[model samples]
Target: MTLVNNPSRTARAGVPRQARAGRPPRLSGRRLAPYLFILPAVVLFAVFKLYPIGWSFVLSLFKTVGGVDTFVGGENYSRLLQDPLFWTALKNTAIILVVQVPVMLALATGLAVAFDSTLLKGRSVFRLGFFLPMVTGLVAYGIVFSVLLNEEHGLVNWALSLVGVDHVPWLTDPLWAKVSLGIALTWHYTGYNAVILLARLQTIPRELYDAASVDGAGAWGAFRHVTLPGLRPAILLTTVLSTIGTLQIFDEPYVLTRGGPDNATLTIGVYLYQNAFVFFDFGYASAIAYALAVLIGILGLIQFRVLGDKK
Candidate 1:
């Protein structure tokens, strides 16, 4: 009888009451902790991002005047189609996107590749100099560039005179105004692209380079065969980002030219701002904003498809 009693005691001690077969394990503390930590960030994102997007979409369907709203379905979009200024802005943005992104990416890629070379000296200084324009405040830099590009007495013309080139009307002429904006944007962001490409370059395995060298591959051959493939993803990323940035270009044009010289520098973003803040057409502006989002999404998809095909 004592043995039987002791056996029951041993069995009871072998397993706790909580681990009995009839009940499932409790997850109240363990599973809830992670979600509790992330709840604040989720709330903030919903408040800031999703809320604004929804509000913008709703506003786009209405005609707002003096803080009063009236539902006017699709009228704002119809105005966009009819407006010559909107078309002009779209044309200008397309021109810049076509011309500037390629040039900037090419230059940045060259700079990144050059900087990555072991043959180069003073790499750090060159990198720093290239990145300086980006660090300068946007408005301040725009103001200074406007001064520098002044037609009559600016530093650019002054330097041009030394080389027997005549003064160019950078801000006044439509063609020159667009070119000046492209130059300023390229100058400001090339270093940023270089830094991005350079980081990607570092990840490329050195063994590939060594193997290429052993097989009598010159620098160009190695880069073409190895580096180019390695850099494709980064190139796609920078291209897409630069395209978006150029499409939304406002500050440089706003501060430097105010979309002047016959609205040659006007982008979709500036056009939207002109409608909303300048003309006090909030509904139209909201429509313009949504249109831009759609444009970006479509273009981004095209880019992704093309890049995917190439890969």
Candidate 2:
């Protein structure tokens, strides 16, 4: 007996009619649905994010004169090299970055460990109390801190007087102004970092800890061998984020000190805002912005190199 294969049967058996005919199959609505759903997001990103970034780079290369933009090539960047105020702002920013990031992350790590402990009572309440500061508005918190740290008649100074100690200049003296900014930053973001670390901590397997215990490891040994390795990614994440945030710090210094006490707290971000909005020197502002972006990128790379997983 002779058997013949039917085209319809072949097409129905997981072979497309288009494929059999040597033509590409058309994309069905199901396949196209994801792209269609994401199209709006893609369009929004291009218009709002990408377009503005590209325009800013172009704007950096041009100088505005008589309400018209004139192309000046790399002059704005060159000017930044010689600008005394720019260097001062950069120095202040560097100080904050060097001092604040480590202190905040260290505090956050300790908080995370405490929050993760089974022996801790009322964990939820304690966690919420610590995390509440993250939800507070930046300006609101800054203003509150400014009021509390006021040189005369502030609650802090009033309390200090009761203790027979002199009123510490929290936001007035240049050094104290930076210290005050650091304190505000630590309060605001330590909880945020702690939450990130806690989440990562939960993801670590209990079996690993038990195994370490069975192997005669103490709490510190388990933490050093198991916990630290497990927490590397989260630690790196918090470090990078803290570094970036400190580098671009603005609202705190702006509302608290206004980059004051002789420009002690003037960050690159505040200086950029001053150039853009105050001086209306958009070109210089854009240059400052791009310079900041480059600095952030470099620091990010250095962090990755130092902290990223090798295996």
Q: In TM-score terms, which candidate is top?
A: 2
Q: lDDT tens string, model 1, 74-169?
A: 999899999999999999999999998899999999999999988899999999999989899989999999999999979999999999999999
182 Cα displacement, candidate 1 (Å): 0.6
Whole-model lDDT values for every prediction = 0.91, 0.94
The deviation in Å at residue 296 for candidate 1 is: 0.6
Alpha-carbon RMSD, each predicted model = 4.0, 2.3
TM-score of predicted structure 2: 0.93
lDDT, candidate 2, 164-251, per-residue tens: 9899999999999999999999999999999999999989999999999999999999989998889999999999999888888899
lDDT of 2: 0.94
Clashing pairs in 1: none
Question: Clash pairs of candidate 2?
Answer: none
Q: Which candidate is the best by lDDT?
A: 2
